[model samples]
Target: MSGPGTNGAAGAPLLSIEGLSAGFDGQSAPAVQGLTLSVKAGEIVALVGESGSGKSVTALSLLRLLPRSAWIRGRAEFVRESGEIVDLYSAPKGTMLSLRGADISMIFQEPMTSLNPVFTIGEQLTEGLRLSGATRGEARERGERALAEVGISEPGRRFSQYPHEFSGGMRQRVMIAMALLRSPRLLIADEPTTALDVTVQAQVLDLLASLRETRGLSILLITHDLGLVSRVADVAAVMFRGRLVEVGPVGEVFARPAHPYTRALLACAPRLGAPRKRLMSIADILAAGDGPFGRTGRSPWMPPVDGDSARGDGCVLEPVGPGHSVAVVEPGEIAAGAEPAT
Candidate 1:
């Protein structure tokens, strides 16, 4: 696999999103607003935030999986396996259908709900292949191999079982296997390990990492787990209330968080042997006013503003270091001054 931060070929991003926004009908504000991010081939970019921070919404928006009531606006350029650049937001329906499972696939957070209870594992696994014109026999063979590739023992036996017959981790492994069936170039894994135990979580993460190394896969891992981001992601993007607050290399962002929300998130993470203290909430961080957390004159959590007012009323990402940026209401504040401790 290519090194972290390096694209697979020619330094071109596999997926690039800019000024993306999504909002459901009747909602006064968008679930996601003017967000921009990119994923390079063979790299894992973690979208980390608290629940309802719009991370999953961002992923769903990319695939056009959101409900019809949801409206999306922005440019999302994707490099297909064929090297063709397609704007996902404007792609034809047929093109999206052809791309969904073949070029890009998604593993939803809950495999139990994602997998059909009545369908045999093998049948579900091969369904996509069959629809894509593969013969049943060929599809089944590939399905079994995929099961084996995901570390499942007795692939033949497991193929005949139902979703209820497998453990949570096993079901998740099956989901991963299904996602890999078409050898997608990009995998959107939304909280892939959320429902698993700690050990199972580690196994799944390791499996994802191994897949990237073996298949040169690019993954967009959406989760609230900072620890997981630190462990597996090459880049970390933090979100809050539907906006990107900070993004950078995982190590740099962790070592020097420039946004108040990012600092609050790191402080809230459970640490071993650290003195126990009441973890601060996002509201607390915002209400802290112009203290250490708010080195800038105003809090970054001010009301959202349009492009015309962004400079004075809203937050914009500012470069704090090479390839590292944090959102601040005033540019150059965090980039120039010392950041607060977590």
Candidate 2:
């Protein structure tokens, strides 16, 4: 396994997270607890949930990008140098510094914050490429190519333009270009298409798919849009609160959801072939039950009586269809999972 085969086998799963729980309060109960997920080479795994579900937190914890005050737990194994695993939580600062953009890169939700408003888009993009070992000239060349790859025309002049000069969609393309500057094996994209118009979003998604196919980059896409997730993800993980409620290949999960929470979520979405008389609303869920997860629902792990002091009727994640897992709990219990907000 020296060439393409080596890349396929060796470049597999740049990041793996197991039982990860992290938060700013450093409480025993993490904002997202007992989270287990992975990103494989050339694959897209979508992490979907409503607001406050800990999807973004999960990504931030992986890069150690959270504030110093926060406490992160669990083992994050980053594969590098052929079969090596590094614990991101307790790793030395040096390990973190090296891993940040080289081995695994991340694209945050907001381009304005991630990109320096003061610097021209070109300068910002060039800076990242340079930091990863590209010479200034080479970085410039790559930056231009990156912009073009992301569908930004006139990449050379745009390089000298600040973020303010670009439209929201253009800024997103710049962010994507910056993230793609290097041949990163894993990319954690937290709502990369947020705030973009529908047309722009479609373009960006297409660009992402093409880029992924060409480079075989593993992607962790965190978004609230189940439709978007279905478009890009090979597998989907649905979280509630801070727990994983269900996970499986995209098609199976969409076709026949086993978990009651899942059924409720899907019922909320507009089905192309089904009628749209009713939409699932959180308000309905809140009113129907005694707990935050809903009291009268058909699932377990519902929220506590007051949204605090959770009722521990933990549901076991059971397989429904092949390659699909759903948490099975008592009828009155709510699903204990984090909801990743937009």
Candidate 3:
């Protein structure tokens, strides 16, 4: 898998995953199993899943950023900025590190962990820029410009400040600035606006969309926020038990979801600032053979595949239309065909 597709700018997918499975330390079950998706050039693919659904892990594995204790397997094909295809799963360390923070950057959920408090924000930003071949003076100027581009105010003043000195939204802007310093071809933003207020969230989301369009940046956005995904993502993939339960164009999936799980997710959302009614929510842990998507692995935590589930009751994903895929419950199943496996 040295080179599988055209370069990132060649009007093709920049990243592709096939049969990917990842397991954390001390767990026999994979946090994610048999996951697959692709990010076309200048397109944003949202990996939407709740807590423990392996959304973040999937992103982390792409750059081989997962801990050594974690076990990872399967195909991870990527096109570099130079337009060479490579298998990210087994990429050489030197090559991977070179691409990281330069060709492809990630803005993780927690800013504090991603940024070093000891360093000034400007220093943190300039460091990456300079390392990527910009002169020190150029790095400083570019850093300020990037911050301003993300809608941060008083960019010059903020550039000299430490991470703690900035508000949450400002800090996130700085993170974006750092991520975009080298104008990476692919950007992986994991829960970029999780804790921000609504107004700022909207602004940040808009900035992301704008940047993607203007810079022609391919992106893989991992988040549990359906609202954010609905706002910025071009394509959507719903994951349950480490498998892609549904995937398609954002508009298509959002308006007419084919998977039972995705439909349930929409039903669970608070409507137009409406308050939620008390009800038993879906459980977090899903067992294989217990849902429509079957176990692609040998773990109980995986959703059941069609016709192969324990009770022979679960369903698997089937392609619904051209370029659109989703899971559906099969006919004549347990619960009298009242399939809970969506």
Candidate 4:
């Protein structure tokens, strides 16, 4: 994992995650495993992968928001504006509460469900601010300004309205505003543009970029859209089946994909001039296997295909270039089907 917190001499990262793994109570296999990445100050690092590829799991693990049934392991360190680094994983419950909305905030994927149906926008936004030591009046004014910053037309009026009164785009903006109102040093945005139209998605992304410039906020953006990542991400991390297959500068990773999974994902993206065809699924690529990727290292964590436990962790992440790494997956490493046969 990039040796923790270091971003190739770019100074310390805002958030550094090292070897994080998580599994649900009833699940034999972990949802995420040995995931490591970093988001530097005033930069956007995007975590991109297909659905169920552990993107959301990594984000939730950082916040410790997953259910109690889930067991999480690893270290997530957040560097505050004060230059104090706090490990989120083992920090006390009280510390986590104080950091949640004040120093670190998150904008969940769906605003409709995230926002309370019965509460006014003002109430919802100011609640966190009030808890963070602001008076009711101070919180109210700040909440309105937050709304305006995210491009809300009538911040004052909208502040009094409930979540149902806002359109999908506006609702998403409100979510963004709520997250930014605390003036957090780091923001975890889990699929912030999901369900929004392309135009609205662009607008939301622009707002995030503006926030980064204006507030120097570090952002961890989790999404499946490569186009969106290319537009705003400074660095990109690609995950497949709970493992980070590749990570590096956005342009470099896109230009010279080293991992077989990364190459397949690029091939699957729809291009304007390209013909409409069934996109190649990850399963299809895995089935093709060594035919495409030569000299792959197998992962020891993966369950054996033939019900043999002999194969240890066979995959190893090797540096392919400066600030770039790819998992060399060996033959028989990724067994047939998403899960190995029992």
Candidate 5:
């Protein structure tokens, strides 16, 4: 059943979030505050941020999977396969239950922990279908097909083995297969390649891209790897201190980072074939008298008279280019000689 919200018109966003804030009961500050983002149909949008920057919180909030102590306030609109729009935050329990796995599925980080060690892979893989009313035999047959689809060989034999019997990469493939059993329209992958070798990571990423191409899947990829963002993501949204700092097409954001924080992050990333240099910390950039971008004077992106105001009420995302937005203070508030480039 569709909830109250705007319909998803053709070429409109598959998912849109605005002014989202999530916080635990005891926290003086929210984990995420005033976050806004969109994921178009058949697009891969990477939510990029450092640890504890609210990326994960935003994902959990979308699914309404946070602990009871967590309070969330926001508008999260998702377009269903039927083209009806649903407000995820307010969707009924039954609606969410039907939506999860069938319309939207998640691949969590660390498949080892996500998989049930006590259950055989086949049992676990088929559980969702079984619960959804498929017969045991039907579920098993579909499960095997899913295993094969994810590039696993000898699916029937592998399905009978427990999670502990598989290698890390194989286990990850299993997680992918499980998430795909229902053929979800949107896949939320939270660090899907964590702890894998570079080769395995590439394989998993390739698998995701292939799925997107073949199934017209929209993906919300939550990750800290800028390299990964550059490789597979069509769009990138950067979060800092629980707030969105920059968002745009992957190529544009990478080429011209408008915000100081965004520039600091790019500087910290290790570039191929570049000369070795000490990685600059975000703190270092903030403390630099001349600012992180090597401007002639202190950067306007730095905190003004009030320290927190830099990311607080005074900050807003200004369009620096087509589809590219950066959080910055107004021109009048910027320090002399530290204005952002037009």
Candidate 6:
């Protein structure tokens, strides 16, 4: 997987998203509103947020996988293996179909539901390769090799088995193998370890990290677990209510979070060897107003800005440090970043 151009070189981002917003039909507000982020080649960037915070919608929007009834507005630029950059939002359906599974692939959260119950493992693995002009014999060899690469022993036997025959960990490995069959430059992993136990979760995370190093792969890891982000990600992007509140190197953001939401998330993480106290909930943070910052009257649920337009004078993302940004509301407005009264 390592090649001349595969190394993490200083160049344009592999994937760049800006001003993205998506909404289903009959909905007035978008699920993802004005979101912006980027993933560099050979790097792991984790997008962290709770459920309904638009993390999954952002991924689907980039892949153009939403249904016809959904409306999307944004620019998702993907750099092709051939070094060509294309706007995914405006690209033709044919172009997108060709790019999917080859240029950019995704491993869905649940393997049981992601894998076809009716199709054999080999059949599902070879489907994309066969459609992309691979001969049956070539596809079979590659599929078996992929299974082996994913640490599955007896690839031949596993290839013939059905989805139900495999355990949860094995199924996840299969999903990773399938996603990597085409050697995509960018892989989007949606909560890859959500269902696994702590031990198995560590194994999967190790697998992903190894793949990134050996294959020079870039990954967009969507998860709500800061523990996972701290373990595997080089950069972390925090989302709140469909908006990106902060993004920076994982260590910096974890050590000195600038946003109130981020601080609350860190404070809620369970510490080892500490008193087994009641876990702090997001609701508690909201009720705390200023949250851990203790700025009186500052709540997580601030005034809702107009979602129809982009950021204006009412709010701005000011730099707090190198590569660290925090969204700040204009003074005198009841915003998420409202300061305490004197």
Identify the leading candidate in terms of lDDT. Answer: 1
Q: Cα lDDT of model 1 overall?
A: 0.81
Please give, for residues 192-233, the per-residue lDDT of candidate 6 as tens digits: 999988888888888998898899898999999888888788
Overall local distance difference test of candidate 4: 0.77
| C-alpha TM-scores of all predictions | 0.88, 0.83, 0.83, 0.87, 0.87, 0.87
Residue 184 alpha-carbon offset, candidate 1, angstroms: 0.5
lDDT of 5 by residue, 1-342 (tens): 111111222246889999998899988677887899998888888999888889889998888899999999889999998988999999999999888888889987666798888999999999988887999889989999999988899998998999889988889999989999999988999999978988898888888888887888888999888888777888889987788988988888899787666777787776779865576665555554332333333233543323343235456677777788877655466654434443
**Model 1 segments more than 4 A misplaced:** 1-3, 6-10, 272-277, 287-313, 331-342
Steric clashes per prediction: 0, 22, 9, 13, 0, 1
What is the lDDT ranking, best to worst? 1, 5, 6, 4, 3, 2
Per-residue lDDT over 1-342 for candidate 1, one digit per residue giving the tens place of the 0 to 100 score: 235663323246999999888888997767887898999878899999989879988999888999999999999999987889989999999989888978889998777799889999999999988988999889989999999999999998998899999999999999999999999999999999999998899899999988988998989999998978877788899987788888988888888786777877788786767875577853466554243334445434333223222223255777777678876654343322222223
On residues 1-342, what C-alpha lDDT tens digit does candidate 3 reach at each position? 001111223358788898888988887567877777888888888899878889889999988989988989899888986778889999899989888877889998876577788999999888866766789788888888988888888889988988889887788888888899877899999988887888888887788888986898888888877777787787889987677878987777777776656766666665566887342244322211243234432111234333222343244556765467875544444433333433
Q: Write the per-residue lDDT of candidate 4 for residues 1-342, one digit (tens) a residue.
A: 131222354446788899888888987678887888888777788899888888888888888899999899999899887887889999999889888878888888776698899999899988877876899889989998889888898888999999889988899888888888878888999999988998898888888878877887888899988778877778889987778878988877888877666777777776668875476754555543442234333432233334332232456677777788877544566544423211
Candidate 5, position 265, lDDT: 75
In model 5, how large is the Cα lDDT of residue 282?
53
lDDT agreement with native, every candidate? 0.81, 0.73, 0.74, 0.77, 0.79, 0.78
The positional error of residue 92 in candidate 1, measured at the CA in angstroms, is 1.1
Q: Model 4 compared with the native: what TM-score?
A: 0.87
